[model samples]
Target: MGRILLAVVALLLPAHAQEWRLTRSQSLTQEGTRAWRYTLSPADRAGRELWQKLVLQYQDHLRAGYRVDLGSWRLYFLGGRLRLEPHCPQVNPACFTFGALPVEKGVQDRFLLGLSQLLDQALAQARNTGGNLTLSGLFRVELKPGQAPPYLARPSGWAP
Candidate 1:
């Protein structure tokens, strides 16, 4: 029986290994890679709830404005404000936002653009509701493995 129990535990180890965690934006303040990526796992109930609310709001925004779909997505919170890139970043015209662009376009340019806006709003609302440590808009950072990120600008408020 002990041998069987030990085997079962070993088999379950990998399944339990993937836990949710937030990679603090402050920790990745440095220069190195072109961009940094973070995760918003299911374990983060508050974050996930906020994300769901933002999704509904953003979908409405897109449908009312551009008439586009929000597609599948992943979330990350970095330290900075969103800004519109004057020039086209690549082939995707959707990548060029009227306000600010995201750090990485990933293939779904339009969806990401719309989602970022919603994320900004949700973070602000969350902060106001209580002292919740909610994640805000994602900022561009090039944190090297060992180096710290330099001083960066925070969003002036919310984009009008």
Candidate 2:
């Protein structure tokens, strides 16, 4: 739903890109029906975008899923963020088709998270070989001050 995406966006984005070090971390939690998480530490804009794509995709599968005999099914790829309505061949309802929605550009913090969720949903629907899927590593974006034309000061002897 649009509200779900909006709520996640509003609840996550931060307005300070100057100080802290951006961190990208993921944790896997297996509970009632295996739940996992992939997120960025010191997270920023890009991460959020990735997460958004994932959530919309996850929802698409859930909405479009239908079991003819209650077990076998066909999984549909719902692109990125869900639009006004999605249409799947199996499901006639407009909502079934998670259309092409406007994904926020600079939301990096949550992007990976969304991406992870999407992958998980895909794995679930996909009857292929999939068990140990991972999105691992530290992601960083730096913004440091550069030396000026006049105020440039050379390193005054290296200090420990």
Candidate 3:
């Protein structure tokens, strides 16, 4: 296990340095307008090495509506995702969106909290590791920016 972990960590490091911040986060507005945003965070210390894992994220949401009358509102659904990361992989690369959240929504960012449930199908075991081409959460944005963020890990022996 240690050898595999060392090899993986070594593979993660490249000649160029990587940014360790989250950005391009978006949300909804009260007037029914779309609001896009982002956040950046970094830590500098030499305590627990694991505590210094760099994390970058991007999230976007769109919500548009017209209130011709209060009784009923008009909403046209048109929302997807666009992410770009020249420094790192689009996804966390090491993160596997499986298992369950260890903590509740502690921070204000709450858009992608429940989104994990949408990817629960990937949690099932198949005939082989690569038996099926599971999405494996490569397409799911499962957490929003907040004080209580989602776990960067999974339970002991879970594979997806």
Candidates 1 and 3 compared: the better one by TM-score is 1
Better of 2 and 3 by TM-score: 2
Summarize candidate 2's per-residue lDDT along 1-160 as a digit string, tens digits.
Answer: 9777656644543332221232223345564333222222223455444435543454444446421110011222234211211122221112122324465433332332333234333334221321222222211111113311111111111110
Instruction: List, residue by residue over 1-160, the lDDT tens digit for candidate 3.
Output: 9678547544543311121223343456777734332222221232112112211011111112211110111111222222211121222222322223333332111112211221221222211121221122222222222312121222111112
TM-scores, all candidates, are 0.21, 0.20, 0.17
- Once fitted onto the true fold, the runs of candidate 1 whose alpha carbons sit more than 4 angstroms away are 1-34, 38-43, 66-160
- Model 2 TM-score, 2 decimals: 0.20
Give the number of the best model, judged by lDDT: 1
Q: Look at candidate 1 and tell me the lDDT of residue 90.
A: 24
lDDT of 1: 0.33
Question: Candidate 1: TM-score?
Answer: 0.21
Please give the ranking of all candidate structures by lDDT, highest first, separated by commas: 1, 2, 3
lDDT of 2: 0.29
lDDT of 2 at 21: 33
lDDT of each: 0.33, 0.29, 0.23
